[model samples]
Target: MKVIRFVLAVALLTTLGAIQALEPAPMERFFIEFKPGTGAIIEAGVRADGGQVHHHFKRADALAVSVTSRLAKRLGSDPNIVTMEPDARRYLAAKQALLTSQPLLQSDPFAEQLVPYGVELVQAPLVWDQGFEGEGITVCIIDTGLYEQHEDIDSSFVLGGHSQDPNSQWFEDGDGHGTHVAGTVSAADNDIGVIGVSPGKASLFVVKIFGEDGLWTYASDLVAAAFTCADHGADIISMSLSGSSGPGPERKAFESLYNEEGILSVAAASNGGNRQRVFPASYDSVISVAAVDESKLVADFSNQNKWVELAAPGVGVWSTVPHVSNSWLFTGGNAYQGEPMEYAPDGVVTGQLADGGMCIAAETPGDWSGMAVLCERGEVTFAEKVATVMAGNGSAAVIYNNEPGALLGTLGEEGGWIVAIGIGQQDGQAALDFLGQEATVQSSAPVPGSSYEPWGGTSMATPHVAGVAALLWSANPAWTNVQIREAMDMTAMDLGEPGRDIAYGYGLVQADAALQYLLAKSTE
Candidate 1:
């Protein structure tokens, strides 16, 4: 009897192993392409197989659902299903590594004028001066949520907004990128903070696609947000996010909104700095914007491709951020160079470097008194270097990079540093080369004022064009999306080989010129 029982147990275990082998892998989400008008049936099949449906697009005959790998395979096998793909994650174009200090209030608000060079470069101010500040026109910023309460952003201008994630607040900006983008598009012209391209008159709407933890979202959420904006009467939609994916259901939705509802869509060309196209920016119906610097030269970080439609200022762009003590750095004399830096400051400190502030060796007492000490970024923690400089009566400290490029650094609480800034390798070496020379280094003091900051990305360029589009639309509400796009393209300040090229598209967008062209055309 014992032998017979052992044989049965062995047979049962083998059968169970076979069953486990047949089980499908797990997948969090999937984009299931269904046959025309068969999405409901497929949705039922997905639910029966332990899957959940997040969204369904009847026009594209697709469903965005979550299922196990085995179930996805099973669904793909169904005759009603055309294809099944895993739902890919998309991200905001802003680079987190480039983030510096949060913008702090300054005691003298007028001391350092809040100048949006992009607005000036694009000549949007010319349109503003003509009394067309996107008045009565609505623009939807489809990105991370907007901080409606920002001093630069007029809350009354908001027409309402929605979020794909139910847990997210539609009006709050957990990730600072959205608020900055909003400020660029239409921050209030209230005279207290930085002004936007469209200024006080344009109606702003926020669609929170990204979650609070990070700047990431799925295609389904983006599609949903686009439709929500269309339903809410958005005349223009500005998207600063992208991914390397082929045309899908989202494209259909954007096309529908454009062709059927007459909404103009603008998206970032991406920050990949390559010819590889990213969508929905690559879509034929959406206008793709590239980034330019203050010089009207294409930014090295901006993506380039035949699909690029326009270029706008994107480097060192100052706009609104969540209110915080953002550290600012300024170097003077022959080594004067400015870039973003990170540090915990007790207060403002100013001084000249001793021995070019190269604290290569342990500093002697009184060596750094009444001066800002300079140190190379190696062989010590930022806090350790700052602490050593402070020990010698240093008023402030500057830590520079040993290699090329800029960096963000942190000095620990124990460092007791009053003020600190990080400089690029070239700037640091210059300071080191001129160690004994008389020069002054200044770190920005935290002033209790506004929540504006400077950031750089192709993401920042999209809004400048969008704001211009709103201004044009406000001036001529009867013009179609195609007409407006054509006017902008025709009137663009031609750059990069004197015609359309991958780098600058129709050169930098000329809002003033485009508006004038549209106005003249109206007479005909």
Candidate 2:
């Protein structure tokens, strides 16, 4: 009788689980408040109603106002609240928002290598033109959805799972991360900017796991999304979210999916720059990826621990962003005066141009005649300081970066006259010193075909691995996920302690080496 009942229970659980998958799970409510004068306000949750408020005494001229139990009592009811730490929630919220923003993308200006500029370009060698370009592969990118109209990924969106509550197809990337991930996995190779590892190859499954504000509904949402990815035929899944470790239903769900369905899951080890491991990444089944820089050194910020399986380029790495060009730079000035300026010779500067930008030029006083020359940086916006140089009778502008930091500024696209360029701070300072107040610039050789563009971070690193995975899978369709993983690990050029250390993990992922390894294993 017990045996029959156990079988019956298992059957019922599976049936109900399928039904729940069709509905959006219930969400808990949280509150937030804006820190005054910071221009950043909490996006949702904490509001003026029954929400608790803390007064900033300096902003107000009173001693201490009388405490009201009403707000205190309301806060007490919710367990999610009233753990009552200091007002550190503000910092936590800001960090999350910033992570969701393009911090890494903006950091690319300082990168010495060109690979980090975008996905297709960086991982091109990993892509193979042969069999099973991830055909029928459903990769669920549980992130902000795609722009829906992106030329590379529009055709890959399919609707196998829908939320009963909203009853709509999930196909948009609200934070831009998912779209970039999708593009790396299987963006069609249509003679565009860069080529995906699997061009015209795989089916990308978009799973909206983040909120509009780029926060999660719950850690449980991650687990649920994984199941949906599984049920919807996702052969391989990649997630770039990790902070704290989690267990309970989420962990159980992941184990079941991996063990039972033979699904391959890969995740970011983390960018915390410490020995601490983030959950899910630290989990046993998922492949946790650390990061390496251009010199093939481990990224200083990538998390390390026993769980890290491999490393890839994370520093100043770049990938595509919707509404942003594959190879484009934004300026901080308007083109109201004349045409935009050009760049200086390679190794001329270190950083990028700021708001009051500059156009770097090759050679010296001769090239400076038609272009508003941008110089290197010491302090202030390279563009701003470069603008001072351009004022001496050049047409448009010049930009450079300081010795240590990358230059970042918005482009002023009102007209075509003023072109702006932000450079590295280290390079900027070099230019400034070289030119002496105004650029008494010297002539030099033509610019190399390889100059740096701006990009940054582990968010950048994640897609490199994704693209590499595509290439490996394409070369040998019969190789299992474990084999592909082994190929990457074995082929990676070890950079750390001679044997898998934290700073470079297994080493830099070598595309040709990985392909050779995969092919060799296939023959074996």
Candidate 3:
């Protein structure tokens, strides 16, 4: 029957013949085919250096193929028959050469140089400790779905991972966004990778709202997902996805959650290089998170203006992955597909492969050895181009903004492989400019907290707050959603010029301080 349908469809196309062939009624747009496990590419825009332009095409094969063919034909012209994607790859390779090789965490031994001053770690062996170790708290990660099997995340008591639409298979995230956010909020304190903000034990309800593909999701789905999370007993909903132009059904649904269930919602303020606010974040009931650089300055690309509730460390942070085995072994797994990923130095492999593939040490710079650079998006799209170069790679393949702007994105997997890293506009431009010159590639150890590493955007920052939020909620079961948000705001150490500046928002989230405040208030 399926074969007959295909034959009939082809026959129908043949009948339309000259008209279909000649007029070409917009071939369904072709999209970058992302390999499974990688997160969705939610946004793409212009790059720096004025060397390239980006335009998004809907995920329709006919349209995408038509656009590509046309572009290819256009490239076969005089001033150098060329395609921008390939040019971008070459440009990225050159750029990787100029980067200073250093692991993000290992750089500058001083805490001041690495960890932000705002981060005030709770001293070991507590002083008047509030017992808010998030025992019964439930955080709903409303992005991609969660991976129940991840050792770090506790699914044992996961009330349920529910979805809005019954027909929508999008409840699960093939993309890595939701899981990463979930890890931050409530990954169990299993001796695995990094711990969650709310360490110890808690519940994580995977409330998926985004599809595997598509630039923007229907507001209806978002609304349904939120209501689903609340209905499933979600105490706090941590959302890393964002979009502007709202006040739609989704906003109404979110309002209902706040009014009826008293569900607390947190959203990314967006990574778009503008002050405009994104939805959910812009919504009155939700807490909006902005990005902060190492300098404790608001990331140049992080959305600003009013509507922001707080700020967290958004620059070059790290966390857990669902397929810990695959990611740890550098198997190059794609979180979206939820499959075991294997990475051969090339496409194919020969003898016994090494456990955990070679990782481009964070912050450590090197000449890209014709490999793809993996980067997170933000700052400017050009930052992706730059990281690819500095990583000593041949191509740039960036991930989702991870902040608020656009949470899912795709690599233009047209020519060679792509290298990815999240970058801001200033750094992106600086790297691109460096690519134009003949410069020696720099090298150094990985900087643990600063330098060229995974950082920037609400995506990176959301987990930190989520972890802290978890800790606070755990310590104080009686604290309301509003109360928790208030405590986080009140206890934050101011980083910007006194009071609440946009850069640091109310200040850096101090987990221990918040715990103490909540405990003291409980006594009163």
Count of steric clashes across candidates, in order:
6, 64, 83
Provide the lDDT at 254 for model 1.
Answer: 80
What stretches of model 1 exceed 4 Å from their correct place? 1-25, 96-113, 326-340, 343-450
Highest lDDT: which candidate? 1
Cα TM-score per model: 0.77, 0.57, 0.56
Order candidates by lDDT, high to low.
Answer: 1, 2, 3
Higher-ranked by TM-score: 1 or 2:
1
11 Cα displacement, candidate 2 (Å): 58
lDDT of 1 by residue, 324-345 (tens): 5434334444544333245454
lDDT of 2 by residue, 1-524 (tens): 99999999999999999999886433222221123332112212233442332232222111111123454445445444313211211000101111111234333422322233334333443445334455555566666555556655547444333331132235544445555555555555654433455564666666776643455444445655676788787767777777664543345456666777777777777777788867676677776777665566676777778778777766654333454311222223211111122332212222232223332322224324433355443344334444454544454344444333344443322223333444445444344433323222222222212122223445556656766775566555666777777788887777778888765667667666777777776678
lDDT of 2 at 436: 20
Which stretch of 10 consecutive residues in model 3 shows the poorest summed lDDT?
A: 88-97
Please state the error at residue 77 of candidate 3 in Å: 52
lDDT of 2 at 509: 70
